[model samples]
Target: MTRIKNILSVIPLFLIAVLQAQEVEFGEISKEELLEEKYELDPDAEAAVLYRSQNTYLQSSGGGARLITEVHERIKLYSKNGFGHATETIHLYKGKSARETVGKIKAFTYNLVNDKVVKSELDKDQIFENEYSYSYDQVKFTMPNVKEGSVIEFMYRINSPFIWNIDEFRFQRDIPIKRLEAELRTPEGFNFKQTHKGFIFFTPSTEKKMDNRLGMDVVVTRFDLKDIPALKAESYVDNIDNYRSGALFELVSVDIPGTVYKSYSQSWGDVAKTIGSSSDYKNELDKTRSFKNELDPLLQGKTNQLEILKLLFKYVKEQITWNGVDGKSFQNGIKTTLKEKKGNVADINLLLVAMLRYAGIKANPVILSTKDNAIPLFPTLDRLNYVIAHATINGKDYYMDATEEFSDVNLLPIRDYNWGGLLVDNPNKVWKHIGRIAPKKADNMHLLKVVVGADGTIEGSYQSRLTHHSAYQFRERYKEKEEDEFLNDLERKLSNIEISGYEVKNAAGYEGNVTESFTYEMENGADIINDKIYFYPLAFLRKEENPFKLEKREYPIDYGFPFQDRYMVEITLPEGYVVESLPKNIVMNLPDNLGKYKYVIRHMGNKIQLSTIFDINSEIISAVNYLDLKEYYNQVIIKGLEQVVLAKAANGRDTGSTGNK
Candidate 1:
């Protein structure tokens, strides 16, 4: 972000030294890399990628040519933490009819012995493959004799049946890459579109060559980068993948002589039309006309559209359990989902839309990619990874996803609240865009009535309300654990303080707010010296440390959604006690009206009243405001940890307790 280091010029010098330093073949050990003490690029890196290359081409197999990629990488470990480099895990996408397969993997870890280099070859028996999900598997292997100062190298080839979907490449990782290269060679028939992302920019060299075997001229694209800094993960980004330097290649079209000029890439409108017309999708909703026998009984002739929407949402969410897999299309259709009471995201959400249509409410399915998945860079069907339902209620489009049990109407999982959703109709087979809904006053509010005892123990009645994302988070955990277990966890977070009178409101419903009230008795939570007492008013709710540790940030700060938090405390004092010291009321804000923070402290009657508000009005902050945001949270943290002091009347001398509780 500051200046591009002239790594291109510097790398050639190393390239010259590397040429004669030692052998740098696939199996040959490079003594210079193994004995390397510190990586000049990043001295703190536990490991470094010495050299890595991915060469992809179309190869003939099974009477046709398929996409095949050969990958080779060499790594040098600086410490034990780098041992993970020796273990390789390749994710293979295997469906019912198509798959990506790995071929001929050779791995070796080299180390210096008493007089010569020792090689520990990888055993084929050590390689194991297992299904990670319904449509994905991982082939895992760990090299032998991996340790500190070891140079590990491995090479493998992968052949994918889906030729149009080329593998994306990353130029950066968590560790520095001393030298990185990726080359792609394809026949002239294919026209591919390449897109790049991240703060770093790169250009690839291209050349053409004739292939006699294929009888076509092939284009070779080579990307070479040096001293590529590691992409460290920071707080507040939607996904680190969004900021990592990478490239994506998608086939746009293929025009072979004597063959048809087929288009491999389609517009989003076409993708929506194609999906809406699919038998597995549009037809799924059309078949629900037969569900009237079951739907009529539940609706009971209720004509209220809002009530019907709630009933349908509750029925689908409560009756059918999510299979925990999200997808764009239904696997078993809506009928099977209703009968079996279990299905994937598409099945459950589609069923909701069908029942809604049967009830005379106009509804459709909206497909979008989740936050954790790749950012949808282009208009392609492959970019869509999830589906939810949208309905017009009183001239307003309300989005809903029943995959989550507690998800209410118009409330979706945080992951589903990404960029935007594509609204597609089944009956009409048309598509439109649905904008994202913003959250308002979704604060984690805390109100506490506390009194410090003479024996240094603090007692309080704690009440808190969690709204929006905070509510969903707490309700999710509450559902996962039993009552006592949940209480224990809450106490553990509050420093093992005893909590009673605990009551949870709206735990079973999705609307309004989640209310949690409890009485707490905390020992050693206050300090007493002679006639003075000092304690933190927040109890265990204080933020112990700042979340932003980086001096500078290069990516946007994403809070997923805008949020607010307020803590109001009313600490009652003893009969003769008076306020000895109180934190000064302070306000901190971001420039240009981005965000603001306020800490107001005052004494009301016989109690010290404190009100603190931290609001992030914007959903996201660009990298330019990162340092300001970081400092804002730091001030909030400091104020959250500030202490409140009280002194007994009698000889009202200025004596105070020192040291933190």
Candidate 2:
């Protein structure tokens, strides 16, 4: 009996070893993984990350240190929708003298064939490289033979000469992750500040060890998580990545036993000082003789500071065209940019600032991260990606971006209306809120005149006026399209309608509101049953769906700017028809006056008039109030769907001549 017990104990240990070996590993494909059709945690997920591991450390080579990171990931596709996950792109940063490099890339796709695992290796020729910009390049590859019920895995290593450039390690993505493992090993000399964001909280285990290869002591931080849900995205979010659970490391200082200690970006002042002294930034602004001759003539007779500022802004906008590149530092010098007549954001906006300063207007450069880049969480130089011009006239601040043709003084592009920005003014750097202090209004009014026919068809004349951001968006979207194309698109949006006599005013000028008027005929716009006619008050302009559909939201809703939309509609009843009933007038207001909606309808002799005013005064609504906002929108949608009922006159005796009070 004792001998049997010993054998049973050994068998349990053997089984444990076998189970441990089944865990995912690099260069290994398992039959069980390939057979998994759906993830238990998120059954609706199109794909899932089965396992991921990332290890980053510093290695000493050739009397210098290089940052090395190794990554391995395994993913399973549940349907064709997940095929997009089969392709991977790695971004590499390039500098003037040294650039980051990737090597040792291997990928495979495994699928079950006749109850057996079959794997296809990626071909080396299938990998391709593209130059993303002057400072970045990307390498992309697709796994071979990827399909539903297939498991794909890839591993690669990146070697970076720039030791301070450490990218964030994200724990959450658009797809669910079953298992994750990450480690960061830093030597004793380098000091880094770690920052974490997102709704998920992760605690890292840290340890210290001696490294024989580097001949130094190092600290290791490790993170392990399982069954992490995907970061679900909702509407009106500025940047979903900003709310993703991740850890970022920023190099703060470097210290060596026998060498001088150095500090970097210890505060906002340090960041401003470092960038303000760079040749590509402040140096470019200092040399203004190249465009002085042209600017002098434009501002010679202009004595008003605001006028001079406007003139300089217009001159730079008309002179240089944006090349659609975003950078805080100029790629080419201002002289070359001026001569070429086209440059990146920094090249164009910085020149505008220089010209404004030369014109004796107090202007400076405002460095910020665009909406797509996410808000900067720390005071680091790399956190900022774009720059614009800021000027103060008559004690009022005006932010300008010359890249946008429809943008004017104090009206910046929507992308630049992020959290805030840093004003780089030498030693007097200050943080300024861009979109919060003064809301950008989107005032719009719609007037409609309609006639109901006996055949249930409707003819209407519609006119819309848009101002501020609304006008800017209208001009930006339809400016390049032909009138006929625009009309066709409108018709497609408002189904069952044929538009004619479409006219637009103030589309070519940036100073006034955009006006659009069109005549349209719609079939089946009203329902006529026996002697009664029924139709919606707002017609095609009614709100059919509420935008806030999520049960809960963890991120704030960013509207970019406050807006108001108003509609005034009138419908002349068909001949011999009298109004029987009208939808009740309703008014709803969000808490704290963040938003409001009003709808009123009136019945007159042979006519029905309806008006609605919808407005949101807050640029951003916090997630804490998401339920309130969602309910408010639901009520608005419900009210907009209410219909009006019209009854045929009794005895066909034109009782419609008497107004209903």
Total clashing pairs for each candidate: 1, 0
lDDT per residue, candidate 1, 1-661, as tens digits? Answer: 0111221121111100001122246876656777887788688788999988887776655554566788889989999988887788998876567778998899998898874688898999999999776557899999899888898899998987675567687788878898887888866766779899877889998877766655457778888888888888877778888788988887777676776676757666776777777776756678875687888888886989988998889888888999888787787787777789998888888888888988899998898988887677877676677889889988987788998977877667878877776778866757765566554446788898888776788898988899887788778999999999889988998888999889999988777799999999988878888879888877777777777888778888878767788888887776677677788888888987788888887776567777878788877788899888888888888887788877787675433332221
Q: Pick the candidate with the highest lDDT.
A: 2
How does each model score on lDDT? 0.78, 0.81
Worst 10 residues of 1 by lDDT: 11-20
Clashing pairs for predicted structure model 1, backbone only: 236-558
Model 2 lDDT, residue 380, Cα: 71
lDDT of 2: 0.81
Best by TM-score: 2
Lowest lDDT block of 10, candidate 2: 11-20
Tell me the spans in candidate 2 whose CA falls farther than 4 Å from its real position. Answer: 1-23, 254-265, 427-439, 652-661
- Looking at candidate 2, what is the lDDT of residue 650? 78
